[model samples]
Target: MADILTLETPRLRLRTWCDEDLAVLAAISADPEVMRHFPAPLDRDEAAAMLRRIRDHFAAHGFGLWALERKDEGQLIGFTGLGWTGFDAHFTPAVEIGWRLARDQWGQGFAREAALAALAAGFERLGFAEIASFTALSNRRSQRVMQAIGMHRDPADDFDHPKLAEGHPLRRHLLYRLRLDEWRERCP
Candidate 1:
């Protein structure tokens, strides 16, 4: 088997996805509460397709969103890691940090913990100069995580997500950013 990149936090494991993770990931993706910030809950087929895309991204980029597993329970909670922004925007062609955890897994600091690990890898291992994250204006939860991880938001950087339709409630997004120097100062 090819070696998989895995990041360890105090209570979670961020690792590559496997066939066995599909069901759990599908469940998480289907949860309305878990996917509230997204366009909609994903069906099983969509979840499978997303998993394929994640695997493909890893193949192409050497890194992508890692399947988040709780260390204590050995369960797939969701995912957290880095990915390239796909849509055209001022921030196009940037590396972005993102995360999604099972609703039950919230409020435990897992998102922040995994994000820090991902950011560390992005800077120290992947050598990214900076990383960005964005979410719908209504997604305060994710915004909080962004802030907690040392990412700063500039209002002028906020823009409507091109993929989302105009007038869609979620089209308006807030952008957060962190450069290598900032992360080093915040973490070191």
Candidate 2:
């Protein structure tokens, strides 16, 4: 499939993966500070495999986590987009809005900006009734981004990630959702 470059925000452009992005993405994935909320930092090979998976997702669904670029500098920073959450939880078979950025870009509102663009694409262009996002309970930074983009969290819906072992610290996650109605109200 030809690369699809679909969404753009004021400061960022969300586009498809490219060969040039591999090195930077690998670096970002391998950074401990960037991967602190996840299982572990990805090695180069693991990052390459993840890039392949991301490409496949876009081919299969026409939209996955799009590679993020700083429009001003034309540099890859990270990714923010919609994806199918694939795992079973209190909420299974759901579409999710997610983002990950380079450490230096964290304080600049890039994640929230890219996420709002993704949410608009999912709700306005794609006609999705709802989209959900979840993160390790301790990832307050991500939680803040989700809330900034209008997703609501109810503690009652939090779940232990099925893929993690019982005692794993990252197993406990909080779920957040935004319905089309709510999104429309917020955006309109």
Candidate 3:
């Protein structure tokens, strides 16, 4: 296995995924409420496949969605970190920051805290010039987190997700971006 990279915040630990995390991750993926913004809730087999892809992403790029663990409870909540955007768009071939926490963990600011740490790693450690994040038009919660982390959205950057069918309700997405210089201005 590649050396697992871990990022820490006040209340959460974002670390590489592990064998033990599969069950909880599967559970999180299966939650209809948690998967509401996604195409559909993943079944166990599909969730396992997702985990494999996450692992492969780390192997290929050195960073992927980290397993989110609550420090106080020491339990897997979900995942948050950076990944490459695979679709063709204006923002194609960009690093994307993202997160998904268990429903019970929402409204507690865990996602924001963890995401800030991930952004720091992307900017400070990985030396990325810019990081992008996008969500369906209806995913206000994720959009809020993107804004909270100092990402800016340009209405002109909005585009339909190529992975989704042309007429799908979730096809329309809003892109948010933060450049290294912008991150320095906001964080430093």
Candidate 4:
């Protein structure tokens, strides 16, 4: 699987992660405000492990995450991409699209722009029939983004994250799905 060197959107660039991304990733993981819906803020070791897995995913799949940078400034504000996610029972064997940006970047439409680029890669380039997006039940901002990107909610597809303990605020999550047919329907 050869690495994907670049994926572009109007105001964003989705490219392979590099060593320089370590500090940017660490900043997001350590920010409680940024990680509010996650089970817990990641420590440096956990952050390091995640980046390792992300790189390994790229090596194995050829197309994994593309760390997002501002098109104009080349700043690593955060990342958005489609990745394989199997932990959720309802959406097993799913190629899930997701995004996380610096808190400062919220409400500016970066997540949606970056995510649409990822969705295009998954549905058009990778041949996935459908891609799913999910977030903790209370994470309304994410839910709205899913809707804005033309995804539809299926509460019946909700699942408690396997990594989260019972009764955890982040345990129950909602799913949003968009099929290739649906994407075509929207544009055609």
Clashes by residue pair, model 4: none
TM-score of each: 0.97, 0.96, 0.96, 0.95
The lDDT-based order of candidates, best leading, equals: 1, 3, 2, 4
**Candidate 2 minimal-lDDT segment of 10 residues:** 1-10
Q: Give the lDDT of residue 43 in candidate 1.
A: 99
Q: What is the per-residue lDDT of model 2 for residues 1-188, given as tens digits with 9 covering 90 to 100?
A: 23345798899999999988999999999999999999999999998998998888998888889999999999999999988987877787899998889999889999999999998888887788999999999999999999898899999999999988999999999999999999999888
Clashing pairs in 3: none
How displaced is residue 67 in candidate 1, in Å? Answer: 0.6
Question: What does the lDDT read for residue 55 in candidate 4?
Answer: 86
Candidate 1 lDDT for residue 51? 98
Distance from true position, residue 182, model 1, in Å?
A: 0.5
Worst 10 residues of 1 by lDDT: 1-10
Mind giving the per-residue lDDT tens digits that candidate 4 earns over 1-188?
33465899989999988887988998888899999998788888888888988888888898877789997998999888878995748568888998888899899999999888888877777888999888999999999999999999877888888888898878888989999999988866
Greater-lDDT candidate between 1 and 2:
1
lDDT of 1 by residue, 1-188 (tens): 12348989898899999999999989999999998989999999999999999999999888899999989989899999999998999987999999988899899999999999999889988888999999999999999999999999999999999999989989999999999999889778
State the lDDT at 65 in candidate 3: 95
Off by over 4 Å in 3: 1-4
- 2 versus 3: better lDDT goes to: 3
C-alpha RMSD by candidate, in order = 2.0, 1.8, 1.7, 1.4
**Where in model 1 is the C-alpha error above 4 Å?**
1-4
